[model samples]
Target: MLTPLVDPDGAPFWEYAAQGELRVQACAGPDCGELRFPPRPCCPHCRSFDSEWRRMSGRGRIWSYVVPHPPLLPAYAAQAPYNAVVVELLDAPRIRLVGNVVAAPDAPLNSVDPARLRIGAGVKVAFTLLDDITVPRWLLERT
Candidate 1:
């Protein structure tokens, strides 16, 4: 199974997801409160080391998506046709996250049909335990 590489800077993200909460790291600098995904050790905006993990509303839209054909990593080949999505948070549109869109929180990566995905489609955060890490997945929001 392909797993995420949890580094010290990004550990908190996985920790929050494991607890069923979606959180993003934000710079705590006085003049720069930039929200960043794929957490980093220092703030890119103000180059500040100070930061905080802020809970998200779990609302977002599909900014982009892809269904890999063949030539995928060996571990992911079995889950071919899975939709990988880039979701732009409603509150922080600048911060986008990469994840798979599933039918339910615990569903497999192929649960959602690839043809059903669309850019600009609304989605919400969902967490699932994959291997030893809890990762965030996306679910299409119903009208």
Candidate 2:
């Protein structure tokens, strides 16, 4: 299993996921109100320092995606080919997020056929508890 990489800014997100909730950063700044993804200390728009963690609907479409070729990083060599997708959350228009789409956390890339994935395919976020972090994964969303 590949241990997820986490940072200080993303800690709150994972912490909330551990509680079975999906949270994303939202700018509370008055001037430049916007939703930030991957979590940030300030709004990328106005550079405002005010921000807060807000829950998301966890529903999005596969705007774009890619299947990594063989000989990936040492950590993902076995997972040679897997989907890394950019999902546009329905709840936040400008807020798009990127992550993997695995059948299950423990399964490898080979677990899900790459050809089966398509652009604009609807997907819903799912979290698998790994230790204390809730890494976002995706599953096919019914139309």
Candidate 3:
């Protein structure tokens, strides 16, 4: 299984996730208020060092996805057909996150059917505690 390596810039992300909250790093520049993922120390838009963690609505759409045939990671061999999805946040379409879609907040990677996923399908964020780190996952929204 994969694990997240928390760094100074990304520590807040994990802290929020542990509390079951979804947040994104946003540039605090007055003229360049932009939201970014994979939290960074400097704003890519304005080169500003000031930033803040903003809570997200946890709503987004599937921008892309894939089901690895030959599991690349040996730990994932047992979950061969699991999916890795790219989701674009509803409020920030330019910001996308990669994760798996499960039936519930804490379900397994393969809990959701691969065939059921579709581009533009609505999804909501969910947190799962893995190895003491709470990671964000996705769940398909019921139409």
How does candidate 2 score on lDDT?
A: 0.78
Candidate 3 Cα lDDT to native? 0.92
Candidate of highest lDDT: 3
Alpha-carbon lDDT, every model: 0.90, 0.78, 0.92
What does candidate 2's lDDT look like per residue over 17-112, in tens digits? Answer: 777677888888886667787687978888898988889888888888888776456777766677788988888867788887777655555566
Cα lDDT of model 1 by residue, 57-113, tens digit: 999999999898872777777777788889999989998999989999888788888
What tens-digit string does per-residue lDDT give for candidate 3 at 27-122? 998888799888999998899999988889999999999999888888998876899999999988898999999999778898898999999999
Off by over 4 Å in 1: none
**Model 3 CA lDDT for position 121:** 97
Question: Worst lDDT window (10 residues) for model 2?
Answer: 103-112
Per-candidate TM equals 0.94, 0.83, 0.96
> What TM-score does model 2 achieve against the real structure?
0.83
